[model samples]
Target: MEPSDLAGMALIAAAGPEEALAFIRAGVSSSPVLEVEMTSLLSEAGTARWPGLADALGRWRPRLPSLAPERDMGVMERLGGGLLIPEDPQWPPALDDLQLNAPIALWMRGQLPRIPEQRRCIALVGSRDSTSYGANVTGELASSLVQRGFTVVSGGAYGIDANAHRGALAAAAGGGASPSTLAVMAGGLDRFYPPGNEGLLRAIAEQGALVAEVPPGTNPTRYRFLQRNRLIAALCEVTVVVEARWRSGALNTAHHAEGLSRSVGAVPGSVYSANSAGCHRLLREGAAVCVTDAAEIAELAGSAGNNLAQEPDAATALHDGLGVEDLLLLDALPLRSATSAEKLSVVAGLGMATVLAGLGRLELMGLARRATNGWQRGAV
Candidate 1:
């Protein structure tokens, strides 16, 4: 096992899933390498990313020989839950898009299939203080999607998320009784957040799933809530924003979805409603396609012949593995004259850190290189 994998395993063994994920989310996690002993899987990305993780791991090592997987598995069995590490057959393939940013382990309750039916899942997201218009649209959309053999995925928060789950539960799954909806929680699945939605969440757990990256007993925190949005995006083939304010966290989920190359759709609400501003913004920015009804939303789920990504031409192949932002940054690099990161940032209209990160990726791909002066183009 890599030092990173050993580090994660040690953390899970010492802290349990909740603390382990907390340790990772502190910004310490790196792209994972697979070798599992996942009571805790520490990041190879190192302690600089996680901060105090190195010291904690040092303190936890003495107990490693005493670790008992069977005991932990028994505890999980009693809770009707289990841990999902990378090597597990049940791990969702869709999460692979997250690359180094993927969760170290998934703490799950209810049934998680051996392989996710991601094509049949669509995430419904919006503001917590959603309006009647948003709720009505989410409800009808969720109901219609469920009827069409699609599972509704959401954050399990109040407003739009709750309505999405309720609508799916209320719809008849003509195929038979099975999961028609699922909630990706920000906190531990052991406790449902917002308390007002407890009853509704319980129903979701009974019929579908309540999944989290953090282990049980972890409270729902604002940052955790924001971080969990990526999970919602990764779990589905399509993400639909029902309504959102200009600064709503739902926009984070939409961004993650787009990064994963999943389809994103935004509902159009009244232009006057501040809640709709985010959707309008996404439409204006071309981040999401405008979707009005269930059928339109379903079309975004996928097409029979169009599921595969279009093959890039040879000219575009040099840009392969580069993200949208990286491509933009690449355009700013000089061919013969190296320029500083500051110059690259202004030229690319990107932040310094983004410029540096993109440069690192480009360097690895042989599309960029560093010189005494700064950085310049490298052979593709």
Candidate 2:
């Protein structure tokens, strides 16, 4: 197909994805008018938005005739993903704040989550090589945030990102209208990066959404990871750093949040912990708010006196009479990944028969789910 006839993402990319203002300034708009504006942007006078616009669009002009979007779309569709441009109804208005750096289009898998308000989309980022303390804190924070009706957003990588995603999924398993989490991937949705996070990424796509700027087949390079951080920051009103060191990439995300004029929150770690140095730095520099829990995070992102997390009723009927072994088993069970009966026996300090029996009971009550991979923590 001709470049003008190309899909929204390809047309925008070829027109000038790198030069954020080129197409918008040329009045290249909605899905219906993208093709027509291809010529509009190419015309001599239309490149006046920026000095480089003319050269940028000019360079793509000849190559437009040879562009092929149909093939790409076929591949994307086979993967159950499609393109998203600013004109799309599901487009997050918060991203427009990026202004000159806004992405031309997004390659996404699954539905884009729509929180009640823009600020309801909260981002949690932190050190990739995190401590057990950091991971536990991050998971609790992420799970609590989602339970409060806010959608958690994070990069789909190791450490903090993985825990954040797992925590969100764990909350979702309880079965309510709480918003689903979103993962803005550094690479293409066609594949998961870090290799280890494949299952978590897949669950997020099935339960929430996953998005990327580049098309399918793109590798996750270091530069791309940095670029993706901007999207994570811009997509949310509040970005929280659960834990980070002096040179952690999570700090980069906090900087992007500050640059975009979004709220930044830092979770304090042990005074001498190297993993928490970056958060301390942000707090010391007064670049981030000291947020110790999900409620504080919600307050920072939400408006005055609203968007409050639903306090669990103290006298609720759920789990009123569970035995000690059941409680311990619940605590030891994982939220997303599976584990074996023997592993559960060891972790919960129960016999194999006891672990197996509890797994069966929890599974029946929707408190636990089973897979050979392991026993999953069920919602209480």
Candidate 3:
């Protein structure tokens, strides 16, 4: 295919599989002009007719998008990160099942860790203004979940979201290939929502996946944030809420996950904290499973093998193959966990470009994973 054709495909892919298919079918059936436009492009580009047709007009159109070049790059720069089109081998197929809500393009800055095939992924969500008890409980649950090989997914907001990511990272540090954590953002990946989480968001993206449905530069509106929650509910096998007010957005996410037939889990909190009201309501309504830690979450979601344990040997081989800067960066990583590029710059005393370049190399070697917060040594 010509570059433009590929670009168009990428743009569509960024829009999510369902929407792309819907647009293509709608164009083909309702607008002869669109079909003609596509045909002309295909002919000029000398692309394979069947694959293009299948991608554009297939039954899955509602789940994908065209991902045109202009749109893709614009989204990327806006997110202050790069784009990962389906063509990128790292693209996760699990997202393809999201239908129209599936993200067409993923706005990301840090590294996307490899998710073990067929592992259970669960989302932990709660109120932005959570109580200390709620936050602490969320963190502990998150930490335990990661220890058992379940990838923890959260919104990356303050309170519960931040706690969950921290818990997962801490658990990952404990030496098993536990489930990595993921954060789905409502705003562009370039900007962290609370601003306080600028560091935390970076770490999640690097070590796991920081995903968004909107194009980069799109500041999340109330409606958009609500819409984004649906994507989170759909991506995971289950959704867990640590705390929420009566009208909390986390409840909306829980509802969406329920509608999708995904399991819903909640952590029962003290009756006094208004933040815990939502969780209590969910439990009363029979909308969620009461969970305490990673093991409980695992029992509800199942578990994966210790894939992370196998990471070190592979990382060793990969590390031995790195260039100088990469070696420097790897050396700079704290033996215990991850650190951000800015911090690494300070620790390694390297320039930003040098750090980034070295990070790219270390990422390739699988010697490190980038978290939404920063960079961390990879689980071997």
Candidate 4:
């Protein structure tokens, strides 16, 4: 509720981000100064002291009733979130690279983890009408990246974005020190957009973070959606488009990422799928490298060394490699004592034929062996 924040909200509501930055550049002094002296400043507009300020200030004057500080504060209080400024520790320094386009203040809900110096954040974006292939790939990549301790950042939309967030949530529940995912919203935090995604957005707010550049009460517009893409790009070290139609909004995010010099990646899709046209275009233009999984994306996000391979742990590796039935049969046949096939079947909840087949596979793989007692798990 500070004067500066109020001033920023007013300017943003009035002249939009680009014009607000113009006002700031033209020696507006401070937000409070602008708020109080706006009339005088406008009266003297087109003069040397306030050149190029008239148009924006003129636009701001009429919108004062709805854009005032008191109204914004009420929405903030109702939403139960706080405002983040440049001085605040949680304010992403990456955004400052946007220079004047950087938000003056961010309306935020939920918590953000301590972003590491190397920027272990990756963005997962794609078409709103994504295919199952894209959703499957996005979920796999997002969860895997979380397992590798990278945070996933995405716009809180349907299709690929929802899958990415869901994957991160699943990974976090498995228990680890990985940071939570983030969703950048185009509209005010007070009104979650895409009404269908209310449950998912609420869950994300509970488990991760929800961020918006505009103040409360602002509904999303096409212009705002395109503008918000910049925030999504600036928040992470890498931005990936999993699926995009030609001229999709995700392409906008990729452009922002490229402008920031952040790594850009695209998930390849079927040649005929329209959903992948944008990604294919990016790949063809050399705007993005073809990325398929977490390891490749991890390298782009600055994870160096030959460390992408899982660490050597024979027992764990063997366990991980087993099929469900094979694993169950292996567990049924204890390491020290072999058990009968019928007993193993009952314990593994598999049919007798399935148990026999699984036992044969395990025996062939050296994970189980036939003994006088019937079958026993392989020795470590």
Candidate 5:
């Protein structure tokens, strides 16, 4: 590996994934074997050589001391995985939307399928302790997406993530094309953090791709898991939160998707379950589209999905419960011009008092309204 690549890897190892941008802003080049003079950088942080870099470096100084770039490269080689830098063809282009916070490099195993466009990728994520309802919904959505040629992306955690990967695999086995899924991990590819998911991760590495921002041999941490959510969001064109609590991390992924201006979808669940609280919150806040099936999610990929299906005409039932007098008044009311109650009475052949009462009811029901001349039909 190049010296700059090794240095960047060690920097990520020391600073964790979140600080990649900080390292770049501090005068460290991302590649071409640029040497990072930590001693001089720290020295300058204390002096005027780099005034703004002080605060950034002081907080990170203590953490940068334990890094061993050479050793980490050797570990990665032994693991048989490879690094994916931005210049590499395998690097996901959608991540560029993250700007400075985008991953400096990805440590990947297996091969990434060729994506015609980032919109063709979808992220199906939810709570780690998902319920059966969440799992079933996620599996159906993921399988449907894979069958339609979308690549599924998710964190390699338990619950919904596991089901999503399994769904994609099942679809592929049932004669779906390749490029089924990608599992972005919170830890190094060398060690799958949730040992319980070893079998699933192995299948992914064999079928799709297993990727991480952290170097080999690194352990998973709470912070890393949170940071990994952005990758899940950025790697795909749409993110679906199948089930999550009010404070679940899956919401964080959806937020990242929103920040990137990507479409967000949430599945409704039983109102009583705390597991569905986040999805409900997302819908209520207008942060996500209430998606019930794969066809709805497929619409987000620019394909003709559920949204294209003809919907019921809301106006057709706008006057369903109105009384006969009210209906008559509404029908007789002018769509563009206004008509006085006396004129409406003559047009509908009703008495003046009855016409007045019916007009009032129609107005209240939003089927008629007072116009400049008199009463007019409401925009139902």
Candidate 6:
């Protein structure tokens, strides 16, 4: 079929199933361009032959809208690379299973990543204000999945989502051949939401894939974000929640995934943390698999033996001879930066003299550095 015809069909599909069937029936009857065999098949699938059926279908007419090719093209251009219509070979069939809520068109900005040949993609989602435990678990699971040649998918949000992407990138950097990650956005690709993740999102677009259902110039709303979560759940083989509060939007994504017959997993978190309440609820209600690592997540998705087991000696060799005080000081350092002696003393719950002695030993051993204002942990 011609691109214009495909665009028209997509517009009707976006409108909803009933209108799409109507358009298909009308197009088949009037236009020689539409194949009779194809029309008959479509009619058998959902289109109505009798007036009763037609009346039932007519109730959905309001959902259909006129096609705007120029507007669509403009939106595509604003996104940098352009759009991917259903007619495009790169469109994944998984999304077609969404029935009515599936996107009419996709606004994309990068080369579409090749879907893994054997492994199913899984989405990891959670609260934007995730805790250190949540972020660490998200990263480990995402990295494990990537190492096993599974694509990790998530919204390009902060906290858990960002950590998931970073883990995937780390796996890719470690010589994995797969696409590793994908970021689905609520808004248009003209800009990244949260702004802080602009670099990370760009890296994803380059190494993996970044997708959106909305047109450019469209800002994300609370309603749109809820709808976007559905897409993330549907597109993946499974959805995992790393962390979520009682009011988290991540639970909505999990619900949508479960409704669609997709596997759902949740990482168990601290009982005292409000951020873990949603996950705890899911576990209690039998809505999710309790996942502790990427291996467990992959197993739940029916992709077993994909995780790379860690080499045991790697950890032992690094910390085998460390003194108690030195280990305490090391544990006090944040993953991203260093701490001052005073801050380290507070964190390690040690005296200033003890922290200073430990810092001196650590600096001499090439394990830490004294910066202009503070001490930073050095690469081991």
lDDT of 5 by residue, 61-88 (tens): 5556566667777777776667778877
lDDT (Cα, tens digit) per residue for candidate 2, span 218-326: 7788888898999999998899999999888999999999998899999999999999999999999999999898988988887768656566567765555678888
Instruction: Report how far off residue 28 is in candidate 1 (Å).
Output: 18
TM-score of each: 0.64, 0.66, 0.59, 0.67, 0.68, 0.63
**Candidate 2, 2: how far from true, in Å?**
22
Off by over 4 Å in 2: 1-67, 111-117, 175-179, 305-380
Model 5: CA > 4 A from native: 1-51, 59-66, 113-116, 303-380
Number of clashes found in candidate 3: 52
- Per-residue lDDT of model 1, residues 69-161, tens digit only: 576566566878888887777688888766546777787777545435789899999999989999999988988888878889998999889
Give candidate 3's error at residue 179 in angstroms. Answer: 8.5
Model 2: per-residue Cα lDDT at residue 261: 89
Q: List the residue pairs that clash in candidate 6.
A: none
- Cα lDDT of model 4 by residue, 32-146, tens digit: 5454454343333322233333444454445544555567777776766778877778677898776546667788876564333337789999988989999899988988988
lDDT (CA) per prediction? 0.79, 0.78, 0.71, 0.79, 0.78, 0.75
lDDT of 6 at 358: 88
Which stretches of model 3 miss by more than 4 angstroms? 1-81, 86-90, 114-118, 172-179, 303-380
Per-residue lDDT, model 2, residue 106, is 82
TM-score of 4: 0.67
